[model samples]
Target: MEYPLAAANACLNAITTVALIGGRVAIARGNREAHKRWMLSAVCLSGVFLVCYVMHHAQHGSVKFIGPDGARGIYFLILAPHIVLAASLVVLVPKLLWHSFRGNFDAHRRTASWTWPIWMIVSVSGVIVYVMNYLLWR
Candidate 1:
C-alpha cells in the first residue's frame, strides 16, 4: 500500500538538502549570518521531517518493497546508511547547534565538517529511497 505521507517526508529531506548546501555556500562566501539562517532552516525542516515520519509510520506501519530481488539488494544498500546516518542526526544536529549557539565557531565548524556530509547523505538517500519505493516500484 502506498502511504501519501512518505512523499511529504521525502520532500522535506530534499528541501533540507538544498538548505544544507545553501548554508555551506553562505559560509564559504563569508556570510556567517546567512549561513546561520540557512542551517537553522534546514534543521527546522528536518525536525518537521521527524514529526511527519513518525506520524506517517504510526499510521502505515512498515512498508514492504515490491520490486525485484536485485532491486531489493540495492534498496537495502542505500537504506542501511540512510538509517545509520539519520539516527546520528539526533546527536549530531544538537551538538552542531550547541556549538554555534554557545559562540564556539571553531567547534561548530569542526562538527559541521562531519555532520554536514552525513546529513546530506541521509537527506539525499531518503529522497532516492522514496522514489525507488513509491515511484519506480509501484
Candidate 2:
C-alpha cells in the first residue's frame, strides 16, 4: 500500500507537471479555455498527489541511500530542493487557483509563471528521488 501510494504520487506528479507545461503551450497558442482547463486539472491532480504523498511518507520513514557518504550527501542535496519547492508549491497552488477562478487573467499569468517552473522542478525532482530511493538504492 505504501509503495503504491508512492508510485501513484510520482506518476500523478509527472502528469501534472506535463499538464502545467502543456497548459502554457495552450496559452501561447491562444487557447485560453484549454489552458485554463489544463491548469485547473493539473492543480487538482497535484493536490491529490500531495495527499497521497503525505500518507506515504507518514507510513514510511526517510529512504536511505546505499552508497558512500559522498553519494549520500548528494542525495540529500537533491532531496532538500525537492522538499522545499514542494512545500512552496503547495502554498502557492491554492492562491494561483483562486486567481484563475476569479477570472483574473493578469494575476493568473503572473502566478502561473511562478508556479509552472516550480511545479516542473518539484515533479522532476520527485521522480529523481523515487528512482534513487526505489531503484538505485534498492
Candidate 3:
C-alpha cells in the first residue's frame, strides 16, 4: 500500500521543530547533554524527512498549490524562504553537529546562533506548507 508520505513528512517536520525548541531550551538551561541529545534527534529526523520527501516527490512529482488568490500568494511567500533555508540547513546542521562533536563549543555556538532560528522557521514553515497544500486549502 502507498503511504501518505506528504502527511508523514509534515509530521516529521513538526517533530523536528519540537526537538529544535527542546534543544534550545536545554542549552539555555545549561543542560549540555540534553541539548546534544535533542539537537541530534532533530538532525536525524530531518535527515529521514529529507529522504522520504525526495522519494515521495520522485515518485509522485510536484503537488501544486490550490487556494484563493491572496492565500496562494502568501503560501508562496512562506514557501520561498522555507525552501531556501531548508537547503541551507542541509549543510549548516551537519556542520553545526560536527563542531559540537569535535568539542568546538565556541564555533558550534556561533553557528548554532544562526542555525537555530533558521531551522525553526524552516521546520515550522514546512508544516504550514503541508497544511496549506494538503489540509486547509485542499
What overall lDDT goes with each candidate model?
0.94, 0.82, 0.92
Write the residue-wise lDDT of candidate 2 on 1-138 in tens digits. Answer: 327887787789779878888898999999989998998888888879878877887888665567667677777898899999988987788888788789887997898787788888888888887777776656
Better-scoring candidate (TM-score), 1 or 3:
1
True-vs-predicted CA distance for residue 10, candidate 3, Å: 0.6
Cα lDDT for residue 52, model 3?
A: 90
CA lDDT, candidate 2, residue 83: 91
Per-residue C-alpha lDDT of model 3 across residues 1-138, encoded as one tens digit per residue: 243899889999999999999999999999999998999899999989999999889988988887888898899999999999999998998899799889999999999999999999999999999989888766
Per-residue lDDT, model 1, residue 65, is 86
- Model 1, stretches more than 4 Å misplaced? none
Off by over 4 Å in 2: none
- On TM-score, the candidate that comes out on top is 1
Candidate of highest lDDT: 1
The TM-score, computed over Cα atoms with residue i paired to residue i, of candidate 2 is 0.89
Q: Please estimate how well model 1 matches the true structure, expressed as its whole-model Cα lDDT.
A: 0.94
Counting clashing residue pairs in each candidate, in order, gives 0, 0, 0
Clashes of 2: 0
